[model samples]
Target: MIVLPWPPSVNTYWRTFRGRMLISAHGRDYRVRAVAAAVSAQRYGQAKVAVRIEAWVPDNRRRDVDNLLKAPLDALAHAGVYEDDSQIVELSIRRAGLDRANPRLEITVEGA
Candidate 1:
């Protein structure tokens, strides 16, 4: 299991400046990847995986759950928690309600 601060959506992670896609979201990818790496379970050579995400958000904010999933999945891969995100056989992403003070993501992984 790993927990991380909420990340920018994939939609918000890039920008088109001068008509070319560029990384406009600063440090999030690196931060997510680094945090995952530090806490990695090191589950290597896994054939299939199950992922559960409990996304925490503010009271008035509505986040697209699908958009929020990509970053954490990529982070887990980069952290070597699993061989690849393609190995995920079962996936669950849910909104666990509002946390006005601290908005974050809770991720849990298991072999399937």
Candidate 2:
């Protein structure tokens, strides 16, 4: 199980600057934070995995659930939580309503 701070949405995670797509400031910050959060994680190599994600959002604004997964998935892989997100064979995500004081994500990874 891992706990990560809220991540930037896909809309803000990438930017086009001078015709090149680059990671946005929000995305870079989120990746750093995500890596820090997973500092103690053990790599899963290429083993098949099942991941469950719970999101505690900051507000009641309507949002797409899947939009929140990308940054965290890539960041976690960069953190060595797993060899790659491709190793996930099963994935589940649920919005757990608001946690205004502590908007965050809780994720669990298990062998399939």
Candidate 3:
């Protein structure tokens, strides 16, 4: 299981969500994370991959960290990071807390 740190710039969101919107907005992050994980997996491997999110926003300010990682994941899929059989690819996202902690994004390719 190899861990990779995502670039800070990728987490930048100029728009802020208010009220229930914050929770729904989480979808964005989820997409980003998925894309990042996919690409990372393709470059590295698919069978093994995980994503850890370290958010800086206050707990109250956001609903779920998974939402923040979505875009990157979609990007990976769009970039064709999956395998031919699509059986050796895997992506997962785990949320921790708002800190300087290094979120570990793991990607593993089977039979690589």
Candidate 4:
């Protein structure tokens, strides 16, 4: 699976912010783990956030997982989680037997 550098605060934000998306996509039903890493700070009473995301998809539905990433990303962009031009730092996909012991789609995003 893609293991990203997720800070505690960012994890909380994602759990709340993407909770609906996760539920809508039946995330809990899938035997997969999705993670996000981000930098957040408050300055002058304004919050600034930057993020990176890692999504672990199952071997059976790599294509479906690819499609699934689009919506939440768009939603995050719309919500200003990161800049529109945020770049993807890395993407790696590895194949393994069907189980949580191994991951299929390992994606990492940076500058977002």
Candidate 5:
């Protein structure tokens, strides 16, 4: 498993650029951090894989878990964990309760 920082919400991940959308600063930073944290990860190449993400939120407030998938998946793709996010044949995310001092995601990728 690879431990990574919690990603920004999908709502904050993109910004309006004229009439187009672009990755916001927060999104870009998360991508960079994802790559850094995944340095020791084993690449999966083009193989189909299953990814399980365990999230520890800083608060007990409600949040949409699905909205957190894109950034980390994209970051993993960019980091060469697989050719693309499409290679993820299965994905799951769990709300692992609070961790105010160290809110994060623990990700596990396995061959499917």
Candidate 6:
């Protein structure tokens, strides 16, 4: 399992410009992936996996969990948890709760 800081929304990590040469939301996504790779301890090459995302927020509020998934999935791919996010055949996401001191995202990947 790998735990990482909460990633920005997909809207923030993915952007498009009309015929522009920009990639990965101006490299912000790449930076997040780099961090995930730095923290990852294991890598899986071609196995079906299950992913669980526990998002800890600072307070009790309504936030879209789905919006927070893409970046981390991409990060796991970059971290070499699997060859690609497509290997994650099962997924679970939940709002873990408030963490006044250290609100962040926790990701767990297991062979399925």
Candidate models: Cα lDDT each: 0.75, 0.92, 0.43, 0.33, 0.92, 0.74
Model 5 lDDT at residue 104: 92
Clashing pairs in 4: 51-112
> Residue 15 lDDT in model 4?
32
**Order of candidates by TM-score, top first?**
5, 2, 6, 1, 3, 4
lDDT of 5 by residue, 1-112 (tens): 9888989998999999999999999999999999999988999999999999999998898998888788989999999989898988899999988999999989999999
Better of 4 and 5 by TM-score: 5
The total of clashing pairs for model 2 equals 0
Error of 6 at 46 (Å): 1.1
User: Residue 42 deviation, candidate 2, in Å?
Assistant: 2.8
Best by TM-score: 5
Per-residue alpha-carbon lDDT of candidate 6 for residues 1-112, written as tens digits (9 for 90 to 100):
5777667666567556786644466346555654554464566789999988898986677788898787777767776778898898999999988897877778778889
Q: Which portions of model 6 show Cα errors greater than 4 Å?
A: 20-30, 33-38
Per-residue lDDT of candidate 2, residues 1-112 (tens digit): 7999999989999999999999999899999999999998766878888889999999999999999999999998899888899999999999987999999999998887
Candidate 3 error regions (>4 Å): 1-41, 44-60, 83-90, 99-112
Between candidates 2 and 6, the TM-score winner: 2
Q: Runs in model 4 with CA error above 4 Å?
A: 1-54, 59-65, 83-108
Per-residue lDDT, model 2, residue 46, is 82
Q: Clashing pairs in model 6?
A: none
> Taking the tens digit of each residue's C-alpha lDDT, what string does model 1 give over 1-112?
5777777678777778899987565535655554654374747566788889898886666557888876677767767788789999999999988888987888888888
lDDT of 6: 0.74
Candidate 2 TM-score, C-alpha based? 0.95
Cα error of candidate 3 at position 84, Å:
10
Model 5's alpha-carbon lDDT is: 0.92
Q: For candidate 6, which ten residues in a row score worst on lDDT?
A: 21-30
Q: Write the per-residue lDDT of candidate 3 for residues 1-112, one digit (tens) a residue.
A: 3333443233453344563333234445554555554543435234333333343443335455555454444444454553232433344455544444554444333333
What candidate 1 gets wrong by more than 4 Å, as runs, is: 15-42
